[model samples]
Target: MESWGNSTTVTEFVLLGLSRNPQVRAGLFVIFLVMYLIAVAGNSLIVVLIVVDSHLHTPMYFFLSNLSFIDVCYVTTSVPQMLVHSFTERPTISYGRCFGQMSIAVCLAETEFLLLAVMAYDRLVAICNPLRYSLIMNGKVCIILALGLWTFPVLLTLVTFLTLQVNMCGHNVVNHFKCEVQAVLKLACSSTRINGIIMVLASSFTLLFPFIFILVTYGRIGFAVLRIRSAQGRGKALSTCGSHLAVVGIFYGTALAMYLRPQAKRFTNREKVMAIFYGVITPMLNPMIYSMRNREVKGALWRVIGRKVGK
Candidate 1:
């Protein structure tokens, strides 16, 4: 153990993952491994499809590629660490490494939230002001928005991380598998009130704000769809936003369930399961949800595959 600040000693964290039972661990390993593989393959395919298909060279797919990339990063942050913990009898993380993991996880999570918000707004502009969609979401504007989404998370994570550094001293046995902000803070010998407050505020911005924006955007969209005189027109417009709505529902529903309440020791296993949904399962599902349901994406993917096979 190493002393920090005044005289507090900090060492490593013990990650209590899914199960101690070998059989259970094996089962979970298989399940999670499948989820991880799907997440990587699905998200990668989306990125490739978007890049190679000229038909997908639009602001929507541009945002989607970014979203898929973030999803890949997001799942990778936690799942691999958890997998290691599950197999190994003794799993430990160094203080510096734990902090770094926490920082990256939080940053990527916030980035995903911001990206979702940007996508929502893009849909809003596309649906509400169809004529102005091109002007509103031009390449330059998209780049600026994307930069803002990426930068804000790093700044927010830095603030939270700095606050955490002050508290990280003494036996760091993080009960959770991953380096969660709450789990790490619980190990601190020093005061963590400031860290808790910052977490709540950041969570509000990242989770709740995007949720509200999505709700309002979709509410308006629903009203607009109802007003369309032709059923075909309404169907067409609704189809455009359906995939995004599905993604938002899954991502936000799981996130709100996990973070809306106070962190509890008893619910650690439950939290881990829920974390799998948003962090791993959702990412895997996003590409499939969009590609399978959306005609344009499916068409583009088919064409790309056909071209490759031909060559």
Candidate 2:
């Protein structure tokens, strides 16, 4: 507890990270540190490829770049801190810093949810309405969509963050490694009926609706792919949409399971393990998923490598 003038509040939180065993902590640290570095490097490579390769300057790559950027940021928000806390005997975070971390996590999550939906739409346009793909998803339109992806999530997160700033009554021991909003909310001593309502609403908007939108958009894309007369055309269409769908499945599946499920009073080890899926594992997998399965991305990478070697 800390005092401000005459009032006392929780100024810091002691984080009970993943393991208490020093050997276990050391092992987890090495594995996660390797993952974190791979995630950052992989995502950064995609961004660089997209920027330098003019042929890849379309709506799909634009959104892919955005996704990569988000994954990089998303993992950075929690993983580094988690890594630090993992090995520490008494890992702690300041109250203000915890709030900031929670807020950023919320914003990035909401943004990625909406962004994935937008990517599905872009694929739908390219495959379903090929003739009008350029006209329908013009640069101006893509820019507008990108702006909305970044802006709207921040606004929504702000509302959720504000509602979460309730009286915690000096309960400052965080069960999980990171400052997850829901985990933090459990510490609040004040009536959290409004906060719960707001959380449900926010989750519905950010997680539920966007997930449904992606599914429906893919449904339409599936139909359009079937209509293609050429087997090669159909295969190409599937290839284009497949990587995005894979990412969507891993991301949305873990996210929905974590956020929309019935709330638990205590943050279980199972929940802590679940948090690693979306927070750490997903980002690491994303760039590899996109690059390995994507021919154009691979070609762009080789081209860049060839140029460097030639120079």
Candidate 3:
């Protein structure tokens, strides 16, 4: 079936992007480019510090390194193209590339959600079962978890492709800057009920379930903190969990808002803006939050810097 308003099978799509005005586009280009650069550098530094510092060889840092890596990959998949499109006239993307972006971006994002849940569990074990933490989160298990985090996204890509049928009508103008899944799907001439259903299920599994897990895990952690007799001990315990909680709050808040919204009709421009904020803004902010709130990470970073100076 051909698209209702369009006649040709869409081979490529023209992204209308955020602005049509040259001045505004140029300003946005500069802003997003700077944000992308900061995000890459910040997350890259976190991964490096985690890998190089022996003191950070614990499970928490290991998971954090993976999270940083995913953040870098996630920002790269989406932001660079947006920057390019901001400058170019009538920015367009091929059908294949659009899905390619969607695959990589979604995979990275969902994997982060899973990773965060695992991190929450790690925190739980560290706090609640401090004596048995080592035995419980052993080297072998960490390796398996890392491998699973890396591998599941690939499987998700395949499942997403096979299950969803999207036949785009001739309407090839994508509303957002990049080839977002929702926006691209809107071009489809055929019914998207099945796609919506699958996305809802996938969203529940990837986003909702993990979110609930984090809440419950943290709730227990909060109670565990309160049980400590000394105020200093309680403070230390809460501080340990603070940075992760902050990061989770920002990442999940924007993401849940973006993905969980109804897709029955075309999304508003405000929704598009929210997508850009989370896709670009969150990555840049995560490193800052960790550095400011996490003392150990700061120490590792300073030690790394000192080593460079000494050498």
Candidate 4:
């Protein structure tokens, strides 16, 4: 089938970011750079603490470490280039590079979704079947689930990239800070039916299904918490899941708003703005959410820093 919408003769795309105003772009660059540094430092610290702290060797921290690693990859996939482009007069991306960015972003995003789902299940088992929690989420099982979470998304992203390759020629202007899948797909000169289908399927698997799982798991957890007589018990239970819930809400909310929403040319600017929430802000927030609210992570971070300072 012929590609949908207008066809361009160029192979690569030019990213027209938020502002052409030099002052505005300069300010954005500085702001994003600061955010990027914070994201890297915060997420990296989480990963380091998880590795060093023997107390954090459980399934929960296993998933938390992986989530931190994914966040690092997630932000790195798009943010630096975006920061540079914000300051540069002409921001151009090669077709291959665009595909690479999309592939990495989609893979990491989907992986995080799957990881979050696994975490919810972990929480469910811990709450609902505390005795069998260790059996169900043994080291072997955790490794297998984490592998699947990471690999499945990589495969899906590859398929999407192949699908896009068939129709990507000319009119390379991408009106966003990064080469988002939907935005890039809009520039294709070939039928996007396959791409759309794949995207929807991936979204369903990665976003909708996991969301439902988290809701159900949390519902069960809520019931379990209610049954506990001690107020401390109830508070502890809520505390365990609260950060994950917040991260889930922010990440999925912006992601769905950008991808699942109707595609209109007029919404491009709005979409780009929303993309920043998930791509940049969420990564930066995850570490803070866990560090400030999570007792174990905070303790581990403090210990690590204290050791470093002593050294």
Candidate 5:
């Protein structure tokens, strides 16, 4: 009887997606559908172009291809579920699947954190020590970095695991588009101190640490460029850093506001909006950011198109 009682409680959760209004929901469905399609296609194209174009197969493109692939997975992990809930009147998800989404999201977010850091280090080596760049970020080193990106995130899985311990008491409604961490934790009747602490600690490691590393790398790159005598060389170096800084600003700004600022104890409508900004908008724009900022990417894209047209 005790086991059954515990099991039956909160069998599933209802996600009160973006809106209840028919017009708003219809509009949102189309919007997210378009965003998803573009994000996948754009990122996949980046990956494929890098692989096929021998000139593009450097450490930077390797990391970029990995980033593109992760963007596909990260967006897929959340957007499809949101799309499903948009049209359905109920917008419900089972308990297992809800937590499952949380776990996957954590994994992807952590992986991106480390991958971005490795990319920063790659840039640091490239700009600050151009002659030794190949020796430092060789194929073997890059592979190890990629492997660690995927493997070292088990520490974050504990957040969702701890979430399972919270007692939902059979009431099944989550007031957001997806199974966001803080939102789901709100449903629990028991103490959530551990979960909250885990969130903060995890956020600090994944967000703060990588951010600090990137800043230090840029600092080094700045000093290195100042030593260059040619004006054109300095401009080229600054431009590369500018593109990466833009991505970092968008990603960290929204993500920190959404997760870290939730210290107020509840996930609010504002946080949902912030989530949409980082979760959907940022990923969609990443490819454009890279391609538009870097001339090489644009040239490679045209070459690929030209090859296809020639055939």
Candidate 6:
């Protein structure tokens, strides 16, 4: 990863960020700044709530704490930098820093997808195998799963980056904001055929496979829910799964649109807009979705607030 390509030395990349107009950039700066703050504060609160409350010490919240921590890191990976660049006249990221951010983003994003599938399976076991849920998803099992979920993505990212044998030849103007893998690939003077193959293989494991697994897992959960004779019981089952399903739909929808689309279509302004949905919107919405739908989370929030107020 030297900045030097074969012919020319490339030291930095100029980012043609989200907007060009000064007024538009100013407005975007304000809006995205607010979004960044809200996402950080909200996810941070979820992590805090899960940690401080005994009621949230179950396998589900343990995974959620991981999710919250990931979301905080995920958004922080790009948003703060993006915010600063938004208002600046010339937005640039160093060659080394650009790939550094991309690698971190990949690790966090892929880990979130894998963690979501694990959460779905957790819900399935809890709902379908209620009698042995605790034993099945015991403390040791949860720890191992969390470790795998986090570890696999880091390796995937590292492998993906190492395999990208790209030569820039001094071409370094990135069209979109941030160092998105696709956008960077488009700048390669060398053939990206090998890089494309590697990315597709990696995306299959990180995005497509986990998405299918989640769908199948949820299908079984749906069937099990239908067997519940009581309407209340059925509703409870759906409520438990609903929050997770909603998050999955938003995440996978945006991600598939971003990664799995026909590669013939080059990275464009539309792609940058699409990236915001998963990159910014989903992380902001995760805690709100879970807290609003989950009574336990709401209860924990109140109890924590009550203690502070009482003191």
Top candidate by TM-score: 6
- Of 1 and 6, the candidate ahead on lDDT is 6
TM-score: which is higher, 1 or 4?
4
The TM-scores of all predictions, comma-separated, are: 0.92, 0.96, 0.94, 0.93, 0.93, 0.96
Please give, for residues 11-99, the per-residue lDDT of candidate 1 as tens digits: 56777776778889888888888899999889998899899999988998999999999989988988887787777998888766776
> Model 4 clash pairs?
3-189, 3-190, 3-191, 8-170, 8-171, 9-170, 10-170, 13-172, 14-172
C-alpha lDDT score of every prediction, in listed order? 0.80, 0.87, 0.84, 0.83, 0.81, 0.88
lDDT of 3 by residue, 109-222 (tens): 889999989999999999899899999999999999989977886787668766786666578888888888788788777888888888877878788999999999999999
TM-score of model 5 vs. true structure = 0.93
Give the alpha carbon lDDT tens digit for every residue of 137-157 in model 2: 999999999999999999998
Q: Largest lDDT belongs to which candidate?
A: 6
After superposition, the stretches of candidate 4 with alpha carbons farther than 4 Å from their true spots are 1-8, 309-311
Cα lDDT for residue 155, model 3? 87
In model 3, the Cα lDDT at residue 176 comes to 89
Q: What lDDT tens digits, residue by residue, belong to model 4 across residues 168-225?
A: 6655778888888888778766766667777787788888888888898889888988
Q: Name the regions of candidate 3 deviating beyond 4 angstroms.
A: 1-8
As a whole number from 0 to 100, the lDDT of residue 148 in candidate 6 is 100
Residues 139-256, candidate 6, lDDT per residue (tens digit)? 9999999999999999989878876788887778898888998898888777888788888889899999999999999999999999999999999889879989999999999899
The residue ranges of model 6 lying beyond 4 angstroms of the native Cα positions read 1-8
Which residue pairs collide, candidate 6? none
Error of 2 at 99 (Å): 0.4
* Better by lDDT, candidate 5 or 3: 3
Candidate 4 at 161: error in angstroms? 2.5
